[model samples]
Target: MAQTPLPDHPMRYALANELHARPFPVLKAPCRAMYLAIKKVENAAERDRSEDLAHLEALLDRYGASRPAPNADQYSGKLGRGFLKWEMHTEFVTYTLFATEPHSEPFSPDLFNLFPRDWLADAPGRIVTSCVVNVETVEPEDREDYMNRNFPGWFVPESLTASAVTEDTAVVVGDFQIDEHGHMRFAVLAHPDITDSRLGRIVQRVLEVETYKSMAMLTLPTARKVSGTVAHLDRELAENAAGMARESNEAAEVLRRLLTMTAEIEALSSATAFRFGAFEAYEAIVMHRISALRERRIGDHQLLSEFMMRRFDPAMRTCRSSKGRLAELSGRAERAANLLRTRVDVANQEQNVEILKAMDRRAALQLRLQETVEGLSVVAISYYAVNLAAGLLAPIGYKLGLDKTHVVALLTVPVVIAVWLGVRRLKHTLTDGEDGHG
Candidate 1:
């Protein structure tokens, strides 16, 4: 008999397997890495996906490497002298290449020669950032001499931050400067005892720290651009809000202005929303990576953590402050709009009250006119009824030897009283039924 299992959800396997995706590279000491992040002028999410795929395919074909499956967001494969890992992100695509061979010179341009010049030139998007990372294995005793010799050549000693990380198994150093090739430089000195996996994690963290830090700073310019627009909106909102107190007629105009401001703020918010969120997220990632370094100071020299905090913390703070300001301004604008709307509503209510008062006056006039018409109707009906009675009673009066005028005089009061009572009773009956239904 065949075994039957319970039905599985469509995404069960994929969701469960996601944790293993993008495993860290196993990098031994004495390895070299060239990391490149590419981004289009428009966001990667908005750019044509086919274009990115085609670019990757072209690059892989040149290296005799198989292309990624369709719609795959990332791929890792061997190239000429190194293996390349490509990942497509929301706003950019990153290519990380690693080679086991170390360059003799610390900041050699020959390291970038692994990439074909023509292929790099034809890349789909501009390079947002690129870095050359060299990991060297050092004996624990020779570490100080290694830094003293290399620090002056590659980094500014005055501003150098070198520290032991991963329980002093490795020491990483960088001055965070762009070199002549327009590439940032990072180097890792690991002990021979460190495992390849731990070294890989350290290398990955360093690269990520640099990448996210660069990505996070891109938002500062956008923040500055919107700051002026927000200030102008704030002043306009304040003026419009103040106008609401002056006159009821101005309420409509104030409401219109408030709506315009709301639209403007919303538009700005929509435009910058993604950037703000990305910056915050990337900033957090940078912090996390720095923390993962577990850096300890080397001989009074600042560590990477301290250097990052001193330089990057201020920019991050500015971004945070700008975001908060935008939110506050938006909230203030919304409240002003609500206030203006309430004022307009109150004005409308007051106008309606005046209209009701006019209607009441008209209703009172109509009631008085109706009463006058009723009185005239009673007179007319009485006159006609008395005439008819006079005609009928004339014969009887002649028989009884009484006058025609006296019969009419006697019947006039009763007829008038009867018609008035009948009209009043009819009106009362209608009103009573209406009241009962209500």
Candidate 2:
């Protein structure tokens, strides 16, 4: 009987398969691994990924191995007598070459030659970190003697970190220092009973810890580079804020400077945000990998985590402190900007109020002058009106036996009052029309 088909999501299989895509490489004891991580110094996250793929393809061509699927982020396959694993990450890529046979001379540089000099030179990005990890099987009885004979010569005593990990499944040792060959060195002495898969995980974890530590510390130089600028800005901000309290300091000038300072702070924040964020993420990975090691101290020497605490932790703290200071300074700048803007606005409002008061005074003076002019105009109009009336009334006064002076006196007061009343009415009407329009 045929079963009914069920609808499935387009990404169902791909998403599920992704979980197992990059399985840890299983390796037997007495093996050597050459690990290399590459990243472009600038805009690494945005670099063309096809170039990375192309570089991988070029290497694969040399071995006559089959190519990885199009747009694959990782690949693992046999190359010559050993194996090659390639993986692409957000901002970097890594290649690991594993050999089953350990070199007689421990920490030998010969295994790294598998990556041809010409091929490495033509890589899409520069090497961020590269390391040689030598793995060996050590009997419980011989472990102490092995360390006595080799550890001192292989690593610096003061900086060396050695610890038993995974309940004594293996012991890992490293100095976290670049050797003369420009490669970090790590040694994993696996217990005779350790399985190949367990050994592989241990080696991978060691490499991851070192790789992330290196990546995380890259942000330290950036933090140091910007420290002087941050200090200068902080001082300027304090002075400007203090000046805000002084009456002699112009609010407008101070506001301008504050705006400039705020812009600079914002620019600095923008520039450093990505690097700081990356640092935090890489730091977390480093710590997590170290924890996964489940390290126990060997004798009185430091554990890997202890070394990180004494050395790496302070660098991480410095970056964190720098980030915090930038944030605090940015906030201070914003607050100062807001206060200065308010002060400037209040000053402008006061100036506007004074201008309005001056306008009101000028309007009052003009009104008074206009009233006096109107009174003089009324007198002038009434003078002409009284003279004409007197001329006409004289004849009539003659019939009643009155003199020209009497006619003039009789008309003057009436004409003057009539002209004044008319002028007042016209002025009131114009004022009323203006008020209605308004």
Candidate 3:
């Protein structure tokens, strides 16, 4: 019987397949691998990823090997007598070439010649790191003799990190130093009993650890370059904060300086944010890869984790401290700005209050002057009115047998009173008009 078809999302199969897309290469013993990682120095994450794919295709074409799918992120195929595996990451790409043929010399520089010089010169990005890994099968009984015979001249003694990994199935050794050929080297002595898949996983982990370590260390230069500037900013922030506390310092000037400091700190944060973040992620990957090795000590030699703790951890700490200082300074600047702004606002409010008081005093003086002028106007009007009345009443006084001086005296009091009443009424009318308008 035919089963009914079920509904499915478009990306269901693609998403499920993505988990197993980049399976570990099955590597046998007595193999030598050359690993190379390439990345653009600037704007790596935003570069034209298609160019990477095109470059990979070009390499595949040179070998007459089958090309990867158009959208594939990883590909593996045969190259001459060896196998080639290519992977694209967010900010870089990696190529790993495995040669199964046994070599006469361990850590030989000639193994890197498989990659043509012209091809490397034509790469779209600069080399981030390159390493050569030698894999050998050594019986447990012969492991000590093997290490004593080959490890001394090949790797430095003080920085050597040797460990038995995967429950003693293999021993891994590295000095974390670049050789005269400008390539890092690692050796994996696998027990005869280990499976090919397990050996491949071990080799992959070793490469990942080294690659991520180099990537993480890239942030060190950035941190060192910015350290002096950051220190200067820190001192400036402290000075501004001190100025804010002093009453004699101008709040506006201090505020302007604080704003400038804030802008500079913000710019620093923006500039370093991506690098610091990438460093942390790469650092975590390096540690996780090392931890996954499940390393057990080989004699008195340091383990990989111990080597990292001593050599690499300090740089990591520096980057963390720089990021933290930036954050602390940003916070301090913000607080200082807020406090200065409040001080400026209060000062302005006090000034405004003084201005209002001055206006009130001027308004009071003007009212007194207006009152004095109105009184003088009333007196002048009364004097004129009394004279005019006496002059007109002189005829009546003569007809009634009265003297001009008596008429003048009678007109003076009545005329002055009338004029005063009229002036008072006019003032009342004008005051009422002003009140109504208001």
In candidate 3, which residue pairs clash?
none
Output the number of the TM-score-best candidate. 2
Q: If the candidates were sorted by their TM-score against the true structure, best first, what order would they fall in?
A: 2, 3, 1
lDDT of 2 at 63: 88
Descending-lDDT candidate ranking: 2, 3, 1
Error of 3 at 153 (Å): 2.1
Q: Write the per-residue lDDT of candidate 2 for residues 213-298, one digit (tens) a residue.
A: 98899899988877878899989998998899898548899999999999998999999999999999999999999999999988
lDDT of 3 by residue, 1-438 (tens): 124587677888789898998898898898999999999999898999999998888878887889999978999999877799999998899999999888888888676776778888888899999999999999988998999998999899989999999999999999989999999999999999999999999999999999999999999998886787888988888888888778854889989989888898899889899999999999999999999999999889899999999999999999888878778888988888898989999999999999999999999999999889878887898788878887888999999988888888888877778877888899899999999999
Error of 2 at 235 (Å): 1.5
Error of 1 at 367 (Å): 0.8
- Can you give the TM-score per candidate against the true fold? 0.88, 0.95, 0.89
Which regions of candidate 3 are displaced past 4 Å?
1-14, 380-438
lDDT of 1 by residue, 1-438 (tens): 124586777887778777776778998878889999888865655888778788889988887899898888888989888889888887788899898876667767675786789988888889888998888999889988988877788876666778899899998888888888888888899999999999999988998898889889998898888888888888887788778767656678778888988998989999999899999999999989988888887787798889878999898888888889899999998988898888788879989999999999999999999999989988898889899989998888878888998888888889889988988998899999999999
Clashing pairs in 2: none
